[model samples]
Target: MHPPRANRAYRNVARVLRPVLYAITRRDWRGTEHLPVGSGFIAAGNHMTNVDPITFAHYLYDNGVAPKILAKSSLFSVPVLGWVLRTSGQIPVHRNTSQAGDSLRAAEQALAAGECVAVFPEGTLTRDPDLWPMVAKTGVARLALTTRVPVVPIAQWGPQLLLGRYAKVFKPIPPKRVTVVAGPPVDLADLYGRPLDAATLREATARVMAAITALLADVRGETPPERPYDMRRGGGGAGADGPAAPTADGAA
Candidate 1:
Protein backbone atom coordinates (compact mmCIF):
# COMPACT_ATOMS: atom_id res chain seq x y z
CA MET A 1 0.00 0.00 0.00
CA HIS A 2 1.17 3.48 -0.76
CA PRO A 3 2.02 5.34 2.41
CA PRO A 4 0.22 8.60 2.88
CA ARG A 5 2.70 11.44 3.05
CA ALA A 6 3.89 12.43 6.51
CA ASN A 7 3.53 15.89 8.04
CA ARG A 8 4.82 18.84 6.03
CA ALA A 9 7.85 19.37 8.21
CA TYR A 10 8.83 15.71 7.99
CA ARG A 11 8.11 15.60 4.27
CA ASN A 12 10.12 18.72 3.54
CA VAL A 13 13.08 17.51 5.58
CA ALA A 14 12.98 14.03 4.09
CA ARG A 15 12.86 15.44 0.59
CA VAL A 16 16.06 17.33 1.27
CA LEU A 17 18.01 14.82 3.35
CA ARG A 18 16.93 11.40 2.06
CA PRO A 19 18.48 12.07 -1.31
CA VAL A 20 21.73 13.19 0.28
CA LEU A 21 21.75 10.10 2.49
CA TYR A 22 21.06 7.84 -0.49
CA ALA A 23 23.86 9.47 -2.43
CA ILE A 24 26.37 8.61 0.28
CA THR A 25 25.22 5.17 1.39
CA ARG A 26 24.00 1.86 0.01
CA ARG A 27 20.96 0.40 1.76
CA ASP A 28 20.24 -3.28 2.30
CA TRP A 29 16.83 -3.29 3.94
CA ARG A 30 15.05 -6.55 4.75
CA GLY A 31 11.78 -7.64 6.38
CA THR A 32 9.93 -4.41 5.85
CA GLU A 33 6.82 -6.59 5.49
CA HIS A 34 7.30 -7.82 9.02
CA LEU A 35 6.36 -4.33 10.23
CA PRO A 36 2.58 -4.47 10.26
CA VAL A 37 0.88 -1.40 8.89
CA GLY A 38 -2.22 0.56 9.96
CA SER A 39 -1.61 0.41 13.69
CA GLY A 40 0.75 1.61 16.35
CA PHE A 41 3.81 -0.61 16.85
CA ILE A 42 7.23 -0.46 18.49
CA ALA A 43 10.32 -0.91 16.33
CA ALA A 44 13.26 -1.64 18.65
CA GLY A 45 16.78 -1.99 17.37
CA ASN A 46 20.44 -2.05 18.32
CA HIS A 47 22.20 1.29 18.01
CA MET A 48 25.37 1.41 15.96
CA THR A 49 26.58 4.86 14.90
CA ASN A 50 25.15 8.30 15.62
CA VAL A 51 23.77 8.29 12.08
CA ASP A 52 21.90 5.02 12.62
CA PRO A 53 18.73 6.96 13.36
CA ILE A 54 18.82 8.69 10.01
CA THR A 55 19.40 5.48 8.12
CA PHE A 56 16.80 3.56 10.11
CA ALA A 57 14.28 6.38 9.72
CA HIS A 58 14.86 6.41 6.00
CA TYR A 59 14.24 2.71 5.85
CA LEU A 60 11.00 3.10 7.78
CA TYR A 61 9.78 5.94 5.57
CA ASP A 62 10.57 3.98 2.43
CA ASN A 63 8.47 1.11 3.71
CA GLY A 64 5.49 3.43 4.27
CA VAL A 65 5.79 4.23 7.95
CA ALA A 66 6.65 7.66 9.26
CA PRO A 67 8.96 7.27 12.26
CA LYS A 68 8.57 9.17 15.50
CA ILE A 69 11.88 8.60 17.27
CA LEU A 70 12.64 8.71 20.97
CA ALA A 71 15.74 10.85 21.16
CA LYS A 72 17.79 12.34 23.95
CA SER A 73 16.03 15.33 25.46
CA SER A 74 19.29 17.23 25.11
CA LEU A 75 19.14 16.85 21.33
CA PHE A 76 15.81 18.62 21.38
CA SER A 77 17.51 21.53 23.15
CA VAL A 78 19.76 22.34 20.22
CA PRO A 79 19.14 25.41 18.09
CA VAL A 80 17.86 24.83 14.53
CA LEU A 81 18.16 21.05 14.75
CA GLY A 82 16.07 20.92 17.90
CA TRP A 83 13.38 23.02 16.30
CA VAL A 84 13.29 20.67 13.35
CA LEU A 85 13.13 17.55 15.55
CA ARG A 86 10.24 18.87 17.60
CA THR A 87 8.33 19.98 14.52
CA SER A 88 8.82 16.66 12.79
CA GLY A 89 7.45 14.33 15.51
CA GLN A 90 10.51 13.06 17.40
CA ILE A 91 9.91 12.23 21.09
CA PRO A 92 12.31 13.53 23.70
CA VAL A 93 13.75 11.25 26.39
CA HIS A 94 14.57 13.03 29.64
CA ARG A 95 17.15 10.72 31.18
CA ASN A 96 17.79 10.61 34.93
CA THR A 97 15.45 13.52 35.57
CA SER A 98 12.22 13.64 37.52
CA GLN A 99 10.42 14.35 34.29
CA ALA A 100 11.74 11.08 32.87
CA GLY A 101 8.37 9.34 33.35
CA ASP A 102 6.85 11.81 30.92
CA SER A 103 8.58 10.29 27.89
CA LEU A 104 6.94 6.86 28.12
CA ARG A 105 3.53 8.37 28.70
CA ALA A 106 3.94 10.45 25.57
CA ALA A 107 5.08 7.40 23.61
CA GLU A 108 2.11 5.34 24.79
CA GLN A 109 -0.20 8.10 23.64
CA ALA A 110 1.53 8.16 20.28
CA LEU A 111 1.20 4.41 19.93
CA ALA A 112 -2.44 4.59 20.92
CA ALA A 113 -2.79 7.17 18.19
CA GLY A 114 -1.36 4.67 15.68
CA GLU A 115 2.09 6.15 15.22
CA CYS A 116 5.13 3.95 14.66
CA VAL A 117 7.66 4.62 17.42
CA ALA A 118 11.27 3.72 16.66
CA VAL A 119 13.50 3.08 19.65
CA PHE A 120 17.18 2.38 20.15
CA PRO A 121 17.18 0.21 23.26
CA GLU A 122 20.90 0.58 23.79
CA GLY A 123 20.35 4.27 24.59
CA THR A 124 23.73 4.89 22.96
CA LEU A 125 26.00 3.28 20.45
CA THR A 126 27.08 -0.20 21.39
CA ARG A 127 29.85 0.08 23.95
CA ASP A 128 30.96 -3.26 22.54
CA PRO A 129 34.33 -2.84 20.86
CA ASP A 130 33.46 -5.39 18.15
CA LEU A 131 29.98 -3.84 17.87
CA TRP A 132 27.75 -6.56 19.28
CA PRO A 133 24.62 -5.42 21.10
CA MET A 134 25.37 -4.73 24.74
CA VAL A 135 23.27 -4.39 27.87
CA ALA A 136 20.20 -2.31 27.13
CA LYS A 137 18.08 0.16 29.02
CA THR A 138 14.82 -1.64 30.02
CA GLY A 139 12.50 1.06 28.71
CA VAL A 140 11.66 -0.83 25.53
CA ALA A 141 10.32 -3.80 27.44
CA ARG A 142 8.29 -1.54 29.67
CA LEU A 143 6.65 0.13 26.70
CA ALA A 144 6.03 -3.20 25.03
CA LEU A 145 4.44 -4.71 28.10
CA THR A 146 2.32 -1.70 28.89
CA THR A 147 1.14 -0.75 25.45
CA ARG A 148 0.76 -4.33 24.24
CA VAL A 149 2.06 -3.09 20.90
CA PRO A 150 4.04 -5.46 18.78
CA VAL A 151 7.72 -5.09 19.68
CA VAL A 152 9.43 -5.71 16.34
CA PRO A 153 13.02 -6.54 17.14
CA ILE A 154 15.27 -5.01 14.48
CA ALA A 155 19.04 -4.86 13.95
CA GLN A 156 21.26 -2.44 12.03
CA TRP A 157 24.81 -2.84 10.81
CA GLY A 158 27.43 -0.94 8.76
CA PRO A 159 26.58 2.70 9.52
CA GLN A 160 29.31 2.64 12.12
CA LEU A 161 31.74 2.12 9.24
CA LEU A 162 30.38 5.24 7.60
CA LEU A 163 31.23 7.36 10.60
CA GLY A 164 32.85 5.92 13.68
CA ARG A 165 31.03 6.48 16.98
CA TYR A 166 31.64 9.88 18.61
CA ALA A 167 34.04 10.86 15.83
CA LYS A 168 33.93 13.31 12.94
CA VAL A 169 35.19 11.06 10.20
CA PHE A 170 32.93 10.28 7.25
CA LYS A 171 33.78 7.55 4.74
CA PRO A 172 31.79 8.02 1.57
CA ILE A 173 34.38 6.21 -0.54
CA PRO A 174 32.60 3.06 -1.64
CA PRO A 175 29.74 4.65 0.25
CA LYS A 176 29.17 2.53 3.31
CA ARG A 177 26.61 -0.22 2.85
CA VAL A 178 23.98 -0.26 5.62
CA THR A 179 21.79 -3.25 6.43
CA VAL A 180 18.62 -3.28 8.55
CA VAL A 181 16.60 -6.37 9.38
CA ALA A 182 13.26 -6.66 11.17
CA GLY A 183 12.28 -9.80 12.98
CA PRO A 184 8.81 -10.78 14.21
CA PRO A 185 7.49 -9.11 17.34
CA VAL A 186 8.91 -10.80 20.39
CA ASP A 187 6.72 -13.18 22.39
CA LEU A 188 6.19 -11.65 25.81
CA ALA A 189 2.96 -13.62 26.31
CA ASP A 190 3.91 -15.48 29.43
CA LEU A 191 5.43 -12.47 31.08
CA TYR A 192 2.97 -9.83 29.99
CA GLY A 193 0.88 -8.26 32.72
CA ARG A 194 2.33 -10.59 35.29
CA PRO A 195 3.45 -7.81 37.60
CA LEU A 196 5.64 -4.90 36.62
CA ASP A 197 8.18 -5.98 39.21
CA ALA A 198 11.94 -6.35 38.66
CA ALA A 199 11.94 -10.07 37.88
CA THR A 200 9.14 -9.80 35.34
CA LEU A 201 10.65 -6.78 33.60
CA ARG A 202 14.08 -8.38 33.47
CA GLU A 203 12.74 -11.55 31.86
CA ALA A 204 10.84 -9.56 29.26
CA THR A 205 13.86 -7.35 28.65
CA ALA A 206 16.08 -10.37 28.16
CA ARG A 207 13.69 -11.70 25.54
CA VAL A 208 13.82 -8.38 23.70
CA MET A 209 17.62 -8.41 23.71
CA ALA A 210 17.81 -12.02 22.65
CA ALA A 211 15.45 -11.45 19.72
CA ILE A 212 17.46 -8.44 18.56
CA THR A 213 20.77 -10.28 18.96
CA ALA A 214 19.56 -13.21 16.87
CA LEU A 215 18.61 -10.89 14.04
CA LEU A 216 22.00 -9.15 14.22
CA ALA A 217 23.76 -12.47 14.16
CA ASP A 218 21.78 -13.46 11.08
CA VAL A 219 22.89 -10.28 9.31
CA ARG A 220 26.51 -10.59 10.39
CA GLY A 221 26.82 -14.32 9.68
CA GLU A 222 28.53 -14.76 13.03
CA THR A 223 27.53 -15.97 16.44
CA PRO A 224 27.01 -13.36 19.15
CA PRO A 225 28.74 -14.06 22.43
CA GLU A 226 26.77 -16.03 25.01
CA ARG A 227 26.58 -12.87 27.13
CA PRO A 228 25.78 -9.31 26.17
CA TYR A 229 28.52 -6.77 26.86
CA ASP A 230 27.97 -4.48 29.80
CA MET A 231 28.80 -0.83 29.27
CA ARG A 232 29.50 0.12 32.88
CA ARG A 233 32.00 -2.66 33.51
CA GLY A 234 33.47 -2.99 30.00
CA GLY A 235 33.11 -6.76 29.62
CA GLY A 236 30.73 -9.45 28.33
CA GLY A 237 30.39 -13.18 29.12
CA ALA A 238 27.68 -15.56 30.22
CA GLY A 239 24.92 -13.76 32.09
CA ALA A 240 26.80 -10.45 32.08
CA ASP A 241 23.73 -8.27 31.85
CA GLY A 242 22.30 -10.73 34.38
CA PRO A 243 19.05 -9.47 35.95
CA ALA A 244 18.90 -5.78 34.97
CA ALA A 245 20.36 -2.76 33.22
CA PRO A 246 19.94 0.94 33.92
CA THR A 247 16.11 1.00 34.26
CA ALA A 248 14.85 4.30 32.99
CA ASP A 249 15.23 5.59 29.38
CA GLY A 250 11.55 4.69 29.15
CA ALA A 251 9.67 4.07 25.91
CA ALA A 252 13.26 3.27 24.99
Candidate 2:
Protein backbone atom coordinates (compact mmCIF):
# COMPACT_ATOMS: atom_id res chain seq x y z
CA MET A 1 0.00 0.00 0.00
CA HIS A 2 2.99 2.26 -0.33
CA PRO A 3 2.54 5.29 -2.55
CA PRO A 4 5.83 5.09 -4.45
CA ARG A 5 7.02 8.54 -5.57
CA ALA A 6 4.72 10.30 -3.17
CA ASN A 7 6.18 8.47 -0.20
CA ARG A 8 9.73 9.20 -1.28
CA ALA A 9 8.96 12.91 -1.67
CA TYR A 10 7.17 12.96 1.67
CA ARG A 11 10.15 11.34 3.37
CA ASN A 12 12.39 14.01 1.93
CA VAL A 13 10.06 16.75 3.12
CA ALA A 14 9.70 15.12 6.53
CA ARG A 15 13.45 14.90 6.92
CA VAL A 16 13.74 18.61 6.30
CA LEU A 17 10.75 19.56 8.43
CA ARG A 18 11.75 17.35 11.33
CA PRO A 19 14.84 19.36 12.23
CA VAL A 20 13.02 22.67 11.85
CA LEU A 21 10.14 21.49 14.02
CA TYR A 22 12.54 20.23 16.66
CA ALA A 23 14.54 23.44 16.65
CA ILE A 24 11.46 25.61 16.87
CA THR A 25 9.89 23.85 19.81
CA ARG A 26 12.91 22.15 21.39
CA ARG A 27 10.46 19.28 21.69
CA ASP A 28 11.18 16.35 23.97
CA TRP A 29 9.55 12.93 23.78
CA ARG A 30 9.42 9.97 26.17
CA GLY A 31 8.26 6.35 26.17
CA THR A 32 9.53 5.55 22.68
CA GLU A 33 10.13 1.99 23.86
CA HIS A 34 6.41 1.51 24.32
CA LEU A 35 5.71 1.89 20.61
CA PRO A 36 5.67 -1.42 18.75
CA VAL A 37 8.94 -1.74 16.85
CA GLY A 38 7.21 -2.99 13.70
CA SER A 39 3.80 -2.76 12.03
CA GLY A 40 0.31 -4.29 12.33
CA PHE A 41 -0.70 -2.02 15.22
CA ILE A 42 -3.01 0.94 15.73
CA ALA A 43 -1.75 4.13 17.39
CA ALA A 44 -4.67 5.79 19.20
CA GLY A 45 -4.45 9.25 20.72
CA ASN A 46 -6.66 11.92 22.21
CA HIS A 47 -7.35 14.80 19.84
CA MET A 48 -6.61 18.21 21.31
CA THR A 49 -5.36 20.40 18.48
CA ASN A 50 -4.85 20.16 14.74
CA VAL A 51 -1.07 20.01 15.10
CA ASP A 52 -1.27 16.91 17.29
CA PRO A 53 -1.05 14.56 14.30
CA ILE A 54 2.11 16.15 12.98
CA THR A 55 3.65 15.90 16.43
CA PHE A 56 2.71 12.24 16.60
CA ALA A 57 4.08 11.58 13.12
CA HIS A 58 7.37 13.27 13.91
CA TYR A 59 7.73 11.30 17.13
CA LEU A 60 7.04 8.00 15.39
CA TYR A 61 9.47 8.85 12.59
CA ASP A 62 12.17 9.72 15.10
CA ASN A 63 11.52 6.37 16.80
CA GLY A 64 11.80 4.54 13.41
CA VAL A 65 8.14 3.80 12.83
CA ALA A 66 6.43 5.50 9.92
CA PRO A 67 2.79 6.37 10.73
CA LYS A 68 -0.09 6.59 8.27
CA ILE A 69 -2.94 8.63 9.68
CA LEU A 70 -6.65 8.38 9.08
CA ALA A 71 -7.51 12.02 8.46
CA LYS A 72 -10.75 13.78 7.68
CA SER A 73 -11.74 13.65 4.02
CA SER A 74 -12.04 17.43 3.77
CA LEU A 75 -8.32 17.77 4.30
CA PHE A 76 -7.71 15.76 1.13
CA SER A 77 -9.36 18.50 -0.90
CA VAL A 78 -6.68 21.02 -0.10
CA PRO A 79 -4.19 21.98 -2.81
CA VAL A 80 -0.63 20.81 -2.24
CA LEU A 81 -1.41 19.21 1.09
CA GLY A 82 -3.94 16.91 -0.53
CA TRP A 83 -1.45 15.77 -3.13
CA VAL A 84 1.15 15.06 -0.50
CA LEU A 85 -1.34 13.17 1.65
CA ARG A 86 -2.61 11.06 -1.26
CA THR A 87 0.89 10.20 -2.48
CA SER A 88 2.01 9.38 1.03
CA GLY A 89 -0.83 6.87 1.58
CA GLN A 90 -2.67 8.68 4.38
CA ILE A 91 -6.25 7.48 4.79
CA PRO A 92 -9.10 9.95 4.32
CA VAL A 93 -12.30 9.34 6.25
CA HIS A 94 -15.66 10.77 5.30
CA ARG A 95 -17.61 11.82 8.35
CA ASN A 96 -20.91 11.27 6.66
CA THR A 97 -22.75 8.16 7.69
CA SER A 98 -22.96 6.78 4.14
CA GLN A 99 -19.20 6.95 3.60
CA ALA A 100 -18.09 5.92 7.08
CA GLY A 101 -17.77 2.32 6.01
CA ASP A 102 -15.26 3.30 3.34
CA SER A 103 -13.03 4.85 5.94
CA LEU A 104 -13.18 1.75 8.14
CA ARG A 105 -12.41 -0.47 5.15
CA ALA A 106 -9.39 1.64 4.35
CA ALA A 107 -8.18 1.26 7.89
CA GLU A 108 -8.70 -2.50 7.78
CA GLN A 109 -6.71 -2.76 4.55
CA ALA A 110 -3.88 -0.67 5.95
CA LEU A 111 -3.65 -2.90 9.02
CA ALA A 112 -3.95 -6.05 6.95
CA ALA A 113 -0.95 -4.89 4.92
CA GLY A 114 1.13 -4.63 8.11
CA GLU A 115 1.30 -0.84 8.15
CA CYS A 116 0.91 1.41 11.16
CA VAL A 117 -2.30 3.45 11.19
CA ALA A 118 -2.80 6.33 13.62
CA VAL A 119 -6.35 7.20 14.60
CA PHE A 120 -7.86 9.87 16.86
CA PRO A 121 -10.57 8.06 18.77
CA GLU A 122 -11.89 11.33 20.10
CA GLY A 123 -13.23 11.91 16.56
CA THR A 124 -12.99 15.71 16.83
CA LEU A 125 -10.67 18.11 18.52
CA THR A 126 -11.35 18.53 22.22
CA ARG A 127 -13.50 21.56 22.87
CA ASP A 128 -12.76 21.32 26.56
CA PRO A 129 -11.60 24.69 27.87
CA ASP A 130 -9.19 23.18 30.37
CA LEU A 131 -7.80 20.74 27.76
CA TRP A 132 -8.83 17.42 29.22
CA PRO A 133 -9.79 14.93 26.54
CA MET A 134 -13.45 14.52 25.59
CA VAL A 135 -15.44 11.35 25.46
CA ALA A 136 -14.09 9.32 22.55
CA LYS A 137 -15.73 7.53 19.66
CA THR A 138 -15.60 3.76 19.19
CA GLY A 139 -13.82 3.65 15.83
CA VAL A 140 -10.45 2.62 17.20
CA ALA A 141 -11.97 -0.23 19.18
CA ARG A 142 -13.84 -1.46 16.15
CA LEU A 143 -10.65 -1.50 14.10
CA ALA A 144 -8.64 -3.20 16.81
CA LEU A 145 -11.23 -5.89 17.41
CA THR A 146 -11.82 -6.55 13.73
CA THR A 147 -8.12 -6.66 12.86
CA ARG A 148 -6.90 -8.09 16.17
CA VAL A 149 -4.03 -5.60 16.28
CA PRO A 150 -2.24 -4.14 19.27
CA VAL A 151 -3.48 -0.70 20.34
CA VAL A 152 -0.69 1.65 21.32
CA PRO A 153 -1.98 4.63 23.26
CA ILE A 154 -0.17 7.94 22.67
CA ALA A 155 -0.41 10.98 24.95
CA GLN A 156 0.76 14.41 23.80
CA TRP A 157 0.79 17.85 25.39
CA GLY A 158 2.37 21.25 24.57
CA PRO A 159 1.26 21.30 20.95
CA GLN A 160 -1.93 22.97 22.09
CA LEU A 161 0.16 25.63 23.77
CA LEU A 162 2.14 26.25 20.59
CA LEU A 163 -0.98 26.62 18.48
CA GLY A 164 -3.81 27.40 20.81
CA ARG A 165 -6.81 25.18 20.15
CA TYR A 166 -9.14 28.14 19.67
CA ALA A 167 -6.69 30.85 18.61
CA LYS A 168 -5.55 29.49 15.23
CA VAL A 169 -2.21 31.11 15.87
CA PHE A 170 1.30 29.75 16.41
CA LYS A 171 2.86 31.77 19.18
CA PRO A 172 6.61 32.25 19.25
CA ILE A 173 6.66 31.55 22.96
CA PRO A 174 10.10 30.29 24.01
CA PRO A 175 10.76 26.68 24.89
CA LYS A 176 7.14 25.67 25.10
CA ARG A 177 8.10 22.11 25.89
CA VAL A 178 6.03 19.48 24.08
CA THR A 179 6.00 15.87 25.17
CA VAL A 180 4.92 12.78 23.25
CA VAL A 181 4.45 9.75 25.46
CA ALA A 182 3.64 6.32 24.09
CA GLY A 183 2.18 3.81 26.50
CA PRO A 184 2.63 0.06 26.41
CA PRO A 185 0.47 -1.88 24.01
CA VAL A 186 -3.14 -2.61 25.08
CA ASP A 187 -4.20 -6.23 24.52
CA LEU A 188 -7.79 -7.23 23.81
CA ALA A 189 -7.17 -10.97 23.82
CA ASP A 190 -10.18 -11.62 26.06
CA LEU A 191 -12.51 -10.11 23.50
CA TYR A 192 -11.03 -12.07 20.61
CA GLY A 193 -13.39 -14.97 21.11
CA ARG A 194 -16.48 -12.74 21.27
CA PRO A 195 -18.16 -10.48 18.76
CA LEU A 196 -17.38 -6.80 18.64
CA ASP A 197 -20.34 -5.47 20.59
CA ALA A 198 -21.12 -1.91 21.76
CA ALA A 199 -20.09 -2.68 25.32
CA THR A 200 -16.73 -4.15 24.33
CA LEU A 201 -16.01 -1.31 21.97
CA ARG A 202 -16.88 1.29 24.61
CA GLU A 203 -14.63 -0.46 27.12
CA ALA A 204 -11.72 -0.49 24.71
CA THR A 205 -12.26 3.20 23.88
CA ALA A 206 -12.23 4.06 27.58
CA ARG A 207 -8.99 2.17 28.09
CA VAL A 208 -7.37 3.95 25.18
CA MET A 209 -8.41 7.42 26.41
CA ALA A 210 -7.36 6.59 29.96
CA ALA A 211 -3.88 5.66 28.80
CA ILE A 212 -3.53 8.93 26.91
CA THR A 213 -4.83 10.95 29.85
CA ALA A 214 -2.25 9.37 32.15
CA LEU A 215 0.56 10.32 29.84
CA LEU A 216 -0.84 13.82 29.51
CA ALA A 217 -0.98 14.17 33.28
CA ASP A 218 2.66 13.13 33.44
CA VAL A 219 3.59 15.71 30.81
CA ARG A 220 1.59 18.62 32.24
CA GLY A 221 2.00 17.73 35.93
CA GLU A 222 -1.46 19.12 36.65
CA THR A 223 -4.76 17.44 37.24
CA PRO A 224 -7.00 17.30 34.20
CA PRO A 225 -10.30 19.14 34.39
CA GLU A 226 -12.96 16.81 35.77
CA ARG A 227 -15.44 17.21 32.95
CA PRO A 228 -14.81 17.47 29.26
CA TYR A 229 -14.64 21.25 28.65
CA ASP A 230 -15.43 21.49 32.35
CA MET A 231 -18.93 22.37 31.36
CA ARG A 232 -21.28 23.55 34.08
CA ARG A 233 -24.93 24.48 34.36
CA GLY A 234 -26.07 27.96 33.24
CA GLY A 235 -23.11 28.08 30.79
CA GLY A 236 -20.67 28.98 33.55
CA GLY A 237 -17.07 27.77 33.75
CA ALA A 238 -15.92 24.62 35.53
CA GLY A 239 -17.07 25.00 39.13
CA ALA A 240 -15.07 23.71 42.05
CA ASP A 241 -15.70 20.16 41.06
CA GLY A 242 -14.06 17.62 43.30
CA PRO A 243 -10.74 16.13 42.32
CA ALA A 244 -10.45 14.98 38.72
CA ALA A 245 -12.36 11.80 38.12
CA PRO A 246 -10.33 8.62 37.85
CA THR A 247 -9.78 7.44 34.31
CA ALA A 248 -10.16 3.83 33.30
CA ASP A 249 -6.39 3.44 33.77
CA GLY A 250 -6.92 4.55 37.40
CA ALA A 251 -4.88 7.71 36.98
CA ALA A 252 -6.29 10.85 38.64
Give the winner by TM-score.
1
- CA-lDDT, candidates in order: 0.77, 0.68
What residue runs in model 2 are displaced by over 4 Å at the alpha carbon?
1-6, 78-84, 172-175, 225-252
lDDT for model 1 comes to 0.77
Model 2 residue pairs with clashes: 128-229
Clashes of each: 0, 1
lDDT of 1 at 247: 22
Residue 212 miss distance in model 1 (angstroms): 1.2
lDDT value, residue 139 of candidate 1: 71
Residue 34 local lDDT, model 1: 90
lDDT against true structure, model 2:
0.68
Mind giving the per-residue lDDT tens digits that candidate 1 earns over 95-191? 6677767777888898998988888777777878888888776777778888898988889898888878877767878788889999988999887
RMSD of each: 3.1, 6.9
Q: Local error of candidate 2 at 202, Å?
A: 0.7
Which pairs in model 1 have colliding backbones?
A: none
